[model samples]
Target: MTDTAPSESTAPQHDALLADLTTIRVGGPAHTLLRPATEQELIVTMRDVWQRGDEWLLIGGGSNMVISDEGFDGTVIHIATRGIQLVSQTDTTLSLRVQAGESWDGLVAKLVSRGWAGLEALSGIPGSVGAAPIQNIGAYGQEVASVLDGIDFLDYDNSEFVHLTTAELELGYRNSVIKEGRAGVVLAVYFTLTASPESTVQYQQLATALGVNIGDGVPVQQVRDTVLALRASKAMVLDPNEPDSASCGSFFTNPIVPEHIARALPADAPRWVVDDEPVADVVVPLGETPAPPPPPKPRLVKLSAAWLIENSGVNKGFRLPGSRAAVSTKHSLAIVNRTGADAAEIAELARYIGACVLSRYGIHLQPEPVAVGVELA
Candidate 1:
């Protein structure tokens, strides 16, 4: 796809470069940019682009992407549609159907203000609601996978609108079926939130910050405030004046490895048990009570990528020779564009970090963002 004249769209302009759209501010120009204001209009645009056999990309807030300096040689669709409707409400439960284009943090703030408790822990996260489920976005031990109930999307194979349930989405830790490169375009997302004044503090750090124990309930608004403050301290929140905020959040996800591999790492390395192998249940004869099973052994472990990077001797604010990219000063896991860093510099820095971790601990850290044309070779 080459640059062409502006086509009919809700928001159409000349060749808008990806650098101007992405949060990191590094990518090259895109062939074309299209923003649709309504679901019907977005569908029509998708169909038009497909029928014409043009390469296309769907961009939301552009928070979790790394495009190459060579730019994307395709049409870019920006989901600019916006609306939120309370689909259902009960004495204890409330359901919201939000447009994919709505800002994620904005939605969380709105819900928390109304005493909804499910998304308070996810406050201050960047990107759009439509992009949430694709990555099963999570923070502070609260994942969108828990609150997300359903999604309405334009199916890639038939160009027809389809609604899928949470189970069908197959959400996992920062992943879902959509991440497999499916062509479904999320038009809206349905979330079921608890109509409660308080939310459970599942994460240890968050609990400690709130002066509470794990599993304790804290006011929803307080949780949101605490989460935002925590994010700001790490420079994870977007701030134009803060150079460390110019990043794609955490560069690498916490690596989930087998228990044995995690045990091989240093004892000081932070780790969390993800899951354990199921133990066999005790069977009983008819009308008899069944016995409890023994404690299961942990089989999966979530290792801290940040710990690995720091322990590998890469300090915060580390940069390659003559490169504009560096690790965020406040957070070891983030890769920031220090001085108008291009995609190459970012990729180089990421490669160096990964190599360091691998050489030190034999664990290859993988990047979390979706790289368009740039790759960490």
Candidate 2:
């Protein structure tokens, strides 16, 4: 491979390059945006970025990030570096290592047809595989962490690339250390997926939405299709026509609060708390009181973030500062770029919305997308 080493006097144009990166079509130009084609290129690019002592952001599919319109004042390394190789597969399980730059939907679809079960439920997510574990990507009923075996990350502190186990990754609900952007850059990921006839439908919403159940043995293809359908309806899937899906999926990590908070609400409210622990999430009804509460269950009670956003009084198309950006008209949770918006406009809009929720509901809405060259408003 040839070298992409920037000279002492030359750097990639930050202006023309800024328009080329990101899903929202916002963000300012980078001092340099490196599109590495292979692992070697990725390494060299990263070394260049770090050695320059300039702030850097690694972009994948560009689906889950919102950058500031002010433009990144430092280097932006675009991981166009891509590939996927299946290491081995038995009659009931498949072990494959995927490059970080490959499209996630494409990867999941390819494996589903081959009868791989672990990733089928994660089919419609829009980022690269490298970012998958960083956020512990999940949908329907499964998180990528379940089938995940390991990851290859550039250990910046060590100045060397390293492999990490699922345990070491410390995966949680849509969170990982790498997703926090501490591991430098993710190059590839490994998964040990089930090829067996059995699949778990742990998410009750998924089963009810699809009209299926666990132990019923559904095909991987059916599950994938159903998940995509449901997500698309909610504007969670990227729909070029609908600005709502253009956002990072579900803007908040469902609040996991203490069981006491759940109990504080009226008995008719939909409250579910961890049975054995003090933690729980009471699914606050949307715009009205719920009919009746579901029975309490063990473990963390999963509540909907969207419900909270709507009840918080910030509706879709909520505008501020001349309408360059606003909440999507179809979905209350997504902050959308409208009418030639820039990164700063979106950042300010997010800040206003987040502040409103925190002030009124006491819920701090953590953004789902990674912010590049921008701080949460």
Best by TM-score: 1
- The alpha-carbon deviation from the true structure for residue 46 of candidate 1, after best TM-score superposition, in angstroms, is 0.5
Clashing pairs in 1: none
Number of the top lDDT candidate: 1
TM-score of each: 0.93, 0.85
Per-model CA lDDT versus the true structure:
0.88, 0.74
lDDT per residue as tens, model 2, 1-377: 34565443233545545534666677777766666667777877677667767787778888778876666777777776678888897887788899988889989988888777888878788878888889898876688888899998887776577889999899888888776556578889999988754456667777886687754667778888888887777677777777665565665566666665555434543444534654455676589876576666645554556666666678877789576777877777777765777777777878887888777667677887777768764
What TM-score number comes out for model 1? 0.93
Q: How many backbone clashes does candidate 1 have?
A: 0
- What TM-score does candidate 2 get on C-alpha atoms? 0.85
lDDT of 1 at 343: 93
